[model samples]
Target: MINAKKLEEIAKQVSESLPPSVKQFAEDMEGKTKQILQSKLSQLDMVSREEFDVQTRVLMRTREKLVDLEQKVAALEASINQQQPESNE
Candidate 1:
């Protein structure tokens, strides 16, 4: 979930940009802005930093295993090719 304090800070910054005439409604504007920001942000697909990092590590490990398996297969194929010629002769 997004941080509430950070959302409030964003809302405050947005409200600060309002003209002097709208200063009387500063509280209302801030509240509404924060609500809208939260609503829209929640609707989007997002992942936290820790979750992304964990997935990255998982991918790295999987890639390493794939490379090892590929090397083993190549070595086995080479050995088979070497034996087939001697038997045919």
Candidate 2:
């Protein structure tokens, strides 16, 4: 059976091997580095590639529809004009 004193001795040895200050400094450095990277990235005006692709597709579709509507309106106007007879009095 493993007694409490042996467990306490093992724990004491583990804690003694590493000083608390060094452990805290390592954690602090990691946090600061993460914050710096995040701040620098946020300053840039950049969209994800997916977002840019979506916008490009939407614009192309809109342009194509507009052109089709314009052609349809022009064709309708032409037909209406042709149906009306010109009278020379």
* TM-score to true structure, per model: 0.62, 0.47
Q: After superposition, how far is residue 45 of candidate 2 from its true place, in Å?
A: 5.0
Clashing pairs for model 1 are none
Candidate that would win on lDDT: 2
**lDDT tens string, model 2, 5-66?**
99999988987787899778878999999999999999999999999999999999999999
In terms of TM-score, which candidate is strongest?
Answer: 1
Clashes of 2: 0
lDDT (Cα) of model 2: 0.95
Model 2, which residues run further than 4 Å from truth? 1-45, 87-89
